[model samples]
Target: MSKESRKFHVPDALANLYDFANTLDLRHFTHHGIQHQQADELHNLAALGEWMRQHGLIERAAAPSQKTFEAALRLRAAVRDYLKCEPAERHRKPAVIGPLNAAMEAFALRVATIGKDGFALRPVTSDAQAGLSAIVAELYDAASAGTLGRLKMCAADECQRVFFDRSKPGTRRWCQSTLCGNREKTRTYRERHRHDPASEV
Candidate 1:
């Protein structure tokens, strides 16, 4: 799997999850040339749902199964839409952030109850629950205060990946510097050299 593909895996900690979620643009399900099959997509949704439950953000809905995975996708899409829209419009639409956050929180709670050893739902430990709760709290705080920081869209022409710009300047332009950034730099270098051969020396 590509580096981008690996990024979607459950993070090691709550802070990492928040950073990962913001950095990822769920609108583009495909990563690193891998088109998601239905099962693959479901897995992604399930993972997010699990993360949500762990964070104490949401309660388990009836029948937590693949169907729940599907529901999570819908919720994910709604959240994406909310983030994509203008702040004023998002506020005007009560169904946006409020519902989305609730869903996320509920999902986190359920996942927390299920434990954190793996994706499967099982009993959670106190430490796990506390960690998840902390993550959820921090995420909500950031969202409420509009201090989530610079959530960025990818600069690659064909890639719509989003990421958190955590650079010193908070002006990062690519989802992954080794990938999209390098590609852009190479392209610019080639173009410049082609246009002005003297500069190559």
Candidate 2:
């Protein structure tokens, strides 16, 4: 795969890692239908660190230790959870996402001063704070513009994960078809066949 595609495409290692960290669902790591909640946080964090390493977001640190992975997971979970809230909610309760955006902007600015990573990294600086600030503003703009309506909850009864559905028909209901859709379809097919024997042949 092309390097950029490999780096950012959803379901790739990095994207999977990002998704895992951003959304905490136990099913991603389960084996034999048993959930492993204990490692959920740690796995999420480790995935982010791996994503950063692959994308050159942060300097490559050593392979994350178990403790480091858990800490990163906790830290990222806090940031992601905070970001998921409405801005008004954030204002009423200052929390990690606010500070993280601040810190990331600062880091972006610091990198910009060095003329190193280009505009992608420029969002971290003071001048770019306006742009960074736009992200928060745009959240409201998007809400006002009806853009937020594109957000959807996965159709799987047991999985309520949220996603932005960019499908042309806008009819997508599951986070992934191979995973949830197939399972539901298979169960339905069996149920119909069991009740209507003529269709089974």
Candidate 3:
């Protein structure tokens, strides 16, 4: 962690706190995320810091250390496991929150209200670890409040990237429609063709 990246800055209020919980976009060898998280990107602390900043987990001046980076990997693994559960199971007492709670406790956090209907979680210290924890805390708050409408894993078993369902009808089944969605659809088509007697090779 460098002072140049964490010494002075104001937290951006416009960022969606729940969004930070999705910092982990694990690589499945098929495609990259809206923010790439390839092995190289994740292994490098500086690149991890840059990704966090873009995702509103940390301010531009907030640098991440090796500890912060390692903690983040742990948190993401916990989250990814949690997302692998069925939706109904998740709504119940799935065994994933234990790790989530542990991850949330990594940093000190306080809820500060800006107005009658606006309050945000802030870290007690300027450390990048605090930023990571605060992001998880904010997500926990959102999930408990029922604001995280439809967080889901991709239907493609091999490409199990978790994503927030942003559809009007809430029918999104793939992490990315253009990529995984299309691939699955093409596979289905091939399967149908293989079964068709008239079109059989």
Q: What is the C-alpha lDDT of each candidate?
A: 0.50, 0.46, 0.63
Give the candidates in order of TM-score, highest first: 3, 1, 2
TM-scores of the models, in the order given = 0.42, 0.38, 0.66
- Pairs of residues clashing in candidate 3: 5-61, 5-62, 6-61
lDDT (10s digit) by residue, model 1, range 1-201: 124434643223324433334434334334588863332222564565555554443465512445455545555455455544443356677767677666555344333333466432323333323333444454454565554444445666555454555577666777788877887898898988898968868
* Candidate number of the best lDDT: 3
lDDT of 1: 0.50
Task: Give the per-residue lDDT of model 2 (tens digit) for 1-201.
Answer: 224334434323223223433345534434368754533323454564565455443445444445444444454454445444443455465565566555333222222333465322233323312222223333334456555444444666555454555577656766577777777788788988898969868
The candidate that achieves the highest TM-score relative to the unseen native structure: 3
Residues 1-201 of candidate 3: C-alpha lDDT, one tens digit per residue: 222122312123212332333344445544443543434435578878886776656888879988878777777777666666665576565478688667656667888787889987777877777667665664656566654445667888657765666678766888679888997998899999987998955
- Please report, as a residue range, the 10-residue window in candidate 1 with the lowest summed lDDT: 120-129
